[model samples]
Target: MAMGIHKFSKRRGRGARAPMAEINVTPLVDVMLVLLVIFMVTAPLMKAGIPITLPDSRAKPLDQTPKQVTITMNAEGRVFLDDDELSPGELAERVGSLPRGADGAMPLVTLRADKALEYGRVVGVMGELNRAGITAISLVTVAGGAPAETAKKP
Candidate 1:
């Protein structure tokens, strides 16, 4: 009877496996996968969009997005054209090489400059865009809840 009875003695692997001495990562992996799917589903829904009433229209929807160019100026004064880096001196010539719209209109230029940048730097970039024959430039800014008092120069 003693021989028939088995025990997980102190000796390694003599009985039941040592309480897994390691973490059961299967549960952690499952949890992480669930969170990833949840975020993937909800991400687009979280986009900020303005609510507006649209007029009824029988016109067919436009086929393609409007042509526009994005120019970003980082805090370090680096310039990017739709993700391509450009030197300050190359702005005018490179911008001129960009294609115009199918209707022959200049593609709208969106200027994004870091707030900490000097005032003159931003203006200089705008001047380059103007010299490139881009006149429909739009300045992107953070939306304020209400109109604020004007800022004055010291």
Candidate 2:
């Protein structure tokens, strides 16, 4: 009788320990779901930028991000570097004088010209960008910001 009582206690102890070994995944799942929601809400708002009408082009998109110099040309032919106003000659000199990449390559230059600017001004900027040794030039444009989108009756 005594031996049987001891055996029963041991079995109960084993069962209690075994339940502890089962992982509690509920909390982990909850944390992951919260993180997912946070990223989704902030993703679109992060994409909004300085409002400028970009010219349309049929060229395939380039793969440059986080490391390109932006040169903005307003309707009055005023140039800016990420908001710092500069003349075309000053832009070329500043871009040319910057340090090269890790691979000893020239920096990529992106030109963001307003749609109302003259073609000749944009062309001149590109010519200067090339002269500054920035051969990898890309024209920046806002995707799908057409006049038809605003003309809708809502």
Candidate 3:
């Protein structure tokens, strides 16, 4: 009887430990690390502009201008005005409706076309922009691999 009572008390004492008042931060930290890695892996894929391989150019980059408009053309000849897809006719109308700058001049247009597209298709888009009274146009291109000195030698 004495041994039974002692065993019962020992079991009770072992089970009566204080409830945990602190959270386990290890699991939380692990989860947060996983989420951070997922975001890092996906961040580059989340770029906002249209994905197209730009033509390479040796020309220097232009200075940043205020109130500039961007137009993108894909290899399929599809046109987009800042991510909104538009037909050729709709593109012209939308470009025409854009508000003029503070100086009463049309905003500078930046055109980005896929390197695989035909010259005629690019020209057609430019013609639309020109018709919309946008005279200041800049062609967007990726910097070429050739160094300045090497390019100058050609």
Worst 10 residues of 1 by lDDT: 48-57
Identify the candidate with maximal lDDT.
3
Residues 31-121, candidate 1, lDDT per residue (tens digit)?
9999999999999676323222222333343322468777878777888887788975999999999887778887778777776788899
Q: After superposition, how far is residue 23 of candidate 3 from its true place, in Å?
A: 24
Return the lDDT, model 1, position 103: 85
Candidate 3 residue lDDT tens string, 27-132 = 9999999999999999967744788988778888877677888899988889999889997588788999999877888888999999899999999999998888
Which candidate number maximizes TM-score?
3
Instruction: Give the alpha-carbon lDDT of every model.
Output: 0.72, 0.76, 0.84
| lDDT comparison, 1 vs 3, better candidate | 3
Which runs in model 1 stand beyond 4 Å of their true positions? Answer: 1-65, 145-148, 151-154
Global local distance difference test of model 1: 0.72
Instruction: Estimate the Cα RMSD of every predicted model relative to the unseen true structure.
Output: 11.9, 7.1, 6.4
lDDT at 1, model 2: 61
